[model samples]
Target: MDSIPSGEGLIARMIEGDESAFTSIYRQYHPALYTYLLRICKIPSLAEDLVHDVFLKVWEIRHRINPALPFTGYLYRIARNHAFKTLKKLAYDEVLQEKVLEHLQFQGNGPEQMVNEKEYNRLFQEALGRLTPQRLHVFRLCRQEGKSYDEAAAILGISRNAVKKHMVLSMRAIHNYIYRQGLVITLLYLAQKIF
Candidate 1:
């Protein structure tokens, strides 16, 4: 079925115990939640299971949903909380924790992985080159030189909070630049493999 036009209407029907409306909600949000949970947990199978659990909770608490408010925010709140809780539980279970860590560790240490890592590092350097001079100085001081924020602030003649803000913005800019260039890197890798 196509997605319902009005979220409030769909949610109202869901609140009234309409299974179809609930199904519509599930179909609408499933992919986004899957991607989100997968990013947090880094395990596809576990992320799928967690998405199901999150929706189950949503169904159980359907009556509490305020249809007038934005549902995506509510859904993401539940997903974020559930993901963190599951990770915490995994951390406490030594056997399970070892298995998960082992799964992550051997995902790919091959030549292809090395090439991708190199590409990512190149992208990172490119991103760093785009930073403002002061931001670059702050980044080098705190990250490259391993200076404390207070020390960087004193050297730069800025407040500690200002140094902190520069670092945050610098990281954000670098991440966004790399993320935007990631598709090109992936396609180049694919082309190299095919050729």
Candidate 2:
């Protein structure tokens, strides 16, 4: 389905308890939700589980859907809430957290294969953490999460110019750190060769 759906047909169909229609809704929106969950959580398995949970909640509450509102919005609202909850849960479990970190580790042809993704993830998180919440929010909303400046600004309740400013700072900080550590150069060189 197109990301911009046509009004509330989905909500109406879902509310009417049309099982196949609900399945269509799920199939149409699953990819976007999965991508959002994966980027935010940085763990594919957890992200997949959360995506399942999001759809399950939508199905479980089918009768409660309001036809006047778009079901896509409702679905994403559930996804976002569930993702945040999962993030918090992951923060509390050292073993599970380590597993997620280990799972994200990168491989290379030789010695580079040994790189610990945990260190990179930790550094990225630390750099992000050092920002004020507003700046970090701007950073994630614009860059990592790929929302447009206008969208991010609206979500942050700020002006587009401010969003640009914070994102500039955030990107500069990230790029500088990555470059100082040789990661940026390596990524850039590889990207130029690959694509």
Error of 1 at 158 (Å): 64
lDDT per residue as tens, model 2, 1-195: 744243477567667886767777878899998997776665678778888999889889888888787666777778877766555555455665554545544332221233357756666676787788888888878777999999997887889999999988888887545433334233233223322
Q: Assess the local accuracy of residue 155 in candidate 2 as a C-alpha lDDT between 0 and 100.
A: 89
Predicted candidate 1 versus true structure: per-residue lDDT over 1-195, tens digit per residue: 766655789999998998988998999999999998887766688889999999999999999999999999999889888776666566456564555545554775222343467778888899999999999999999999999999999999999999999999999999767754653343234334322
lDDT over C-alpha atoms for residue 138 of model 2: 87
TM-score, candidate 2, is 0.48
Clashes of 1: 0
Q: Global CA lDDT of candidate 2, please?
A: 0.68
Q: What is the lDDT of residue 71 in candidate 1?
A: 97
Candidate 1 wrong stretches, greater than 4 Å: 1-5, 108-195
- Model 2 bad stretches (over 4 Å): 1-7, 107-195
| Winner by lDDT | 1
Global local distance difference test of model 1: 0.79
Q: Estimate each model's TM-score.
A: 0.52, 0.48
